[model samples]
Target: MSITVSLLLWVICLSCHAWLQPGRYGLPPPRPGYRPALWGTRLLAPVLALLVTTRHDAIAGILVWCMTASLAGLVVACGLCFGPRIIGTDGRRVARERRP
Candidate 1:
């Protein structure tokens, strides 16, 4: 189950990378550090999910869920906060570079 969750998380990261490529990096070429951080965060999600799902105790599972949810929320908030910085001016620069 943990392996499955890991794979799913990887898939989600890959899809997000593909779909949000331009939006994330503002260029056709991806930045080197971007993928690692994104995938690392994604990889952690399944571990958290597994902790929540397999603890065998209701209270533990609930606590894990809350913690996982908080972590996920933090990840989203970080993305919201930093995503624009990555894609904002750099994206426009990419567009400008493309034009003659």
Candidate 2:
């Protein structure tokens, strides 16, 4: 259960981290108000995950947190790389849109 929670939190954290920098991903810029929410989630989720895990077990919690963070990072990276293709989006189209 703790592992699940940690994984979810890490995924959310990484996703928000990615969203906070659209140019890096070749995505459209976010709205001004949306940035605050992304920043909050990106900053808060990892700490919450850490607290939840450590509350369960100190030594083991840290280990599990590290494992979950690594797996979650891979998950987010795959999602960013392949998600658009899965949804029929073209890389070139996104690149075109990114230009002024």
Candidate 3:
């Protein structure tokens, strides 16, 4: 697959991961009896499989899989850690960028 396509897939995966934890960032809360995090965790397997299949050779396939995994994790972590501050309600930043 083209690098551009791969990047697009990674972005989608990341956004899905972020949506998994919507409440923390003030996006939206999860529904009752439904664990949003669990849904995303389950989805990672299929997404990784799709990403891996994009490459024909074993080496490239492995590399792509690893890359996708790392990027996905980073997205989830960043969303949990910095999402709210990045975009607060009412068009204002929830927290300042400077350290205090």
Off by over 4 Å in 2: 85-100
TM-score, every prediction: 0.35, 0.82, 0.45
Which lDDT tens digits does candidate 1 get at residues 45-96? 5566656455677665555555555555556445555443334434554223
Instruction: Tell me the lDDT of candidate 1.
Output: 0.51
Question: What is the TM-score (0 to 1) of candidate 1?
Answer: 0.35
lDDT top scorer: 2
Query: What is the lDDT, from 0 to 100, of the residue 63 in candidate 3?
Result: 73
The best candidate in terms of TM-score: 2
lDDT of each: 0.51, 0.83, 0.58
Task: Give lDDT tens digits, candidate 2, residues 1-100.
Answer: 9999999999999999887777676566679999999999998999999998999679999998999999999999999886652121332334323335
Candidate order by lDDT, highest to lowest?
Answer: 2, 3, 1
RMSD of each: 9.2, 5.8, 6.7
What is candidate 3's lDDT per residue for 1-100, written digit by digit as tens? 5444554556666665555655445455456555655476457754665555465776776676667657766766675666545545454445557768
Q: Locate the minimum summed-lDDT window of 10 residues in model 1.
A: 90-99
Q: Give the TM-score ranking, best first.
A: 2, 3, 1
Runs in model 3 lying further than 4 Å from the true structure: 30-54, 72-100
